[model samples]
Target: MKEQPNLRDATYQEEAAIDSNSTSIAGLVRQLTREVPSLFTKELALAKAEITEALNTTKAATIGMASGGIVLLGGFIMLLLSAVLGLSNVVAPWLAALIVGGVVCVVGMIMVSAGKKKLDPAAFKPERTINSMQKDKEAVKGKVA
Candidate 1:
């Protein structure tokens, strides 16, 4: 009769592979445990650096953009003067200028407020890195377990 294979006993390659896996997992777990904190610190530092750079850029751009806005506002005010003059045939000139200038300024401020909202620093939180760290934490837990 032919000899039957032993189901309970692992062969040489199987044992080797299992040992290799366990050793690698242990090594990876140790490396992760040691490096994750430092990695997070570095990432945070990078984010702060990038945000600071961005803030500086924003400041410079704001100056240029504000100048452009002023120039545009001057042009618009000139055009609105024509409209105000036309309206002055019916209403008083000062009333026309006040009504048109006030409405234009309010609309411009609203647009600026919308732009300001987009540039808010709080919106640039390190969400991606935080999520990656959380995922890595879960993966390390799975490996250790």
Candidate 2:
């Protein structure tokens, strides 16, 4: 399958030829002013696209973790039961079972929480677009200076 082009990494390439249209510095400024926002809009769209793709991937992983955690709990229940039975000799049966179940539930919840953290939108900040925009800003400032 062919890979889709990443618009965020695109650069404008132009020949150093004079335009037949208005060549005044004001004209250039006008064009830049018009194009800058368009470029930024495109960049932002690209960032959103990238984040969406990452979200799909992270979603799968998060789902896997959550499901695994659930399955682990099912299996852990059996193990805890055995543990409770063994501990019953030392402690009360009900107390032992409660303690074991509580500990296992906490561990399972922690795994689910870790998965939730991975799915956080904040975690998917568009690094490439941010860096590109920063460079663009610096270059524009340098030109103005």
Candidate 3:
């Protein structure tokens, strides 16, 4: 007669097979679903904060774009108005053109000045970063020495 397999060993092998076979893709997904809600909540919160920050900054970006557009549109309209008025013949066309040109130039200069004022070089952090790097290099050299 053929020798029979040991009951305990056979049971252990069956249990291992069950363990391996039970962990299917669906089972893994269910496990992840059970554990991921907290992680999802944290990520969702982070995303919301980032979105809020972007939303807050959007107004400033929009205002900047609108202001630039308005400046361009205003210059265009002024030029058109000047041309129309000059053609209507109350003043000499050349004189009107000169006056309009001067006005436009003045407005452009004012806008440029305003833009320069708004652009603060001090706000950039490059100098601070350079200083920190210089300090770090000195420290590293001292350590090597």
Candidate 4:
């Protein structure tokens, strides 16, 4: 994909050109007043686009995982049935089913626990957008100071 140019970079270049070309402080201030609002609107649009992209990615991945799980579930059920049948040859049928069921339940609990740990809110955080906003915050502070 072709990369989009950064709005901030373009804005900075425009500001630089304006600073050098303009002879009056009033003209510079007037230009800044007009640009700041547009800059903010562009930044918000960029952040919204980033967030939407992240959500779309997560949605696609979830759908794919759910589809794969449905297929795997059918195979898993057959495998479990085979295990129970094989064990039944060595033990009572009831005992074999109980044994397999218990093991499967325990394994499932462990997997759920691990999955819960991995499901931290941070996993879905918009790190790039947050970092960009932080940089912008610091730049604004520097300008103010």
Rate residue 14 of model 3 by lDDT. 66
Q: Write the per-residue lDDT of candidate 1 for residues 24-130, one digit (tens) a residue.
A: 86666665666789877976876677677777877898899899999998998789989899988889999988888888889889998999788876755656667
Candidate that beats the other on lDDT, 1 or 4, i.e. the better one: 4
Which candidate leads in TM-score? Answer: 4
Ranking by lDDT: 4, 1, 2, 3
TM per candidate? 0.59, 0.67, 0.36, 0.72
User: Lowest lDDT 10-mer window, candidate 4?
Assistant: 136-145
lDDT of 4 by residue, 98-122 (tens): 9999999999999889978865767
Shift of residue 19 alpha carbon in model 3, Å: 48
Looking at model 4, residue 133 earns an lDDT score of: 75
How does candidate 3 fare on TM-score? 0.36
Weakest ten-residue segment in model 1 by summed lDDT: 13-22
Is 2 or 3 the stronger prediction by lDDT? 2
Give the runs in model 1 whose Cα sits over 4 Å from its true position. 1-33, 49-57
lDDT of each: 0.78, 0.77, 0.66, 0.82
State the lDDT of candidate 2 residue by residue for 104-138, as single tens digits.
Answer: 78987997798677556677888888888898899
Task: Tell me each candidate's RMSD, in Å, in order.
Answer: 10.5, 9.3, 16.0, 8.8
Q: Model 4, residue 116: displacement in angstroms?
A: 3.1
